[model samples]
Target: MNLFELVEQLFEQYGYLVLLIGLPLDFIALPIPPGNSTLTYTGFLTYKGIVEMVPAFGSAFIGAAIGLTITYILGYKLGMPLIERYGKWLFIKPSLVEKTQVYYNKYGNKLLIICFFIPGVRQFIGCFIGMIRVPYRTVWIYGYTGVAAWVISFFSIGYIFGEQWQYILNVVEHYLKVIFICLACSFLILLVWNRVKREKAKKLSNATRNE
Candidate 1:
């Protein structure tokens, strides 16, 4: 069977346990079924009376939290040394990690909320925050809220659309790609603007000193 068929079969057999266990595994970057697909499928199942709503939602939320928490803890304990050693395998470069740290420093933990809606970003935000040594309380507050909101929004899309939930997944993934592209462009623009501003300031300082 195909991946969707396999996921559906697993959910059929394992019910809430599949969600509870599977979501965290996804968050931890394991190669299980995609979490979005799983949540959407679970929501669809709820619409069909195959699974209860509350339990399904709870499992997704709790499982995501567990996974994110573990990633954060690992990042905190391991820090740059770990990333420097193994990050390349995950496509996590030191420069990317440094850029994330800079953004975190500027925006504080609130950025974590926005990160949730971004696909690849959500997976690494916890680890980046942990590596930066953000306080656990802040991480829990923003990170957990982000997870809850993200889970509910995606799950609701599936629940509402019923049989058409797969289309919603495609649309979301498309938008996430667009968002990342826009973010990359914006970051480049900001970098150029900052460099120009610094160069102008340096010239002015030097000219004034000579006067």
Candidate 2:
């Protein structure tokens, strides 16, 4: 069956349990019913009076938080060690880690606030933060805030649009992908420029020292 049909069937069968289960899977990167689909459908059901708004939202939020916490704990306990052992197979050497650490020092913590809206980023962000040893306090503050915004925005879309939710969701997702692509390209360009600038400075300093 199609994705929409699958979600509708599950919701019909399990009610809020689906949210409690499905959202966690999505956050854990399994995404069987997909987080976006679940939230928007919850709002759609609320609009149809089949589901209570507050409870549905609460279930979603709690489920997401649980999943995020699990990933963080796993990363904290195991991620770096595993990478140090097996990262060579994945080409994740120490130099790569250092470069990533540099970028994370600059933008990673703040990125949590909007990571939920960034598609592929949302799934691994909690683990990433933990792997970098970012404090739980920072994750709780920025991460939960981002989750609230994400849930509210997509849920509002389905509720507000009502019968057109599926169409609207498709349109919204398409544009978001385009925007993310553009932003990723720009970020890469800036990174390349910064690297070149640093290299030039290093070479210039070496030349001066030799003279």
Number of the top-ranking candidate, with lDDT as the measure: 2
Q: For residues 75-191, what per-residue lDDT tens digits would candidate 2 score against the true structure?
A: 788888888999999988756766776787787766677678767878888777777787889888888888888999999988889999999999988987887788789779978
Native-to-model Cα distance after best TM-score fit, residue 6 in candidate 2, in Å: 3.8
Top TM-score model: 2
Q: Which stretches of candidate 1 lie over 4 Å from their true place?
A: 83-100
- Model 1 gets an lDDT of 0.82
Q: How close is candidate 1 to the true structure, as a TM-score?
A: 0.86
Tens-digit per-residue lDDT, 98-130, candidate 1: 876776678756767877777677777777788
Using all chains and alpha carbons, the TM-scores for the candidates as numbered come to 0.86, 0.92
lDDT for model 2 comes to: 0.83
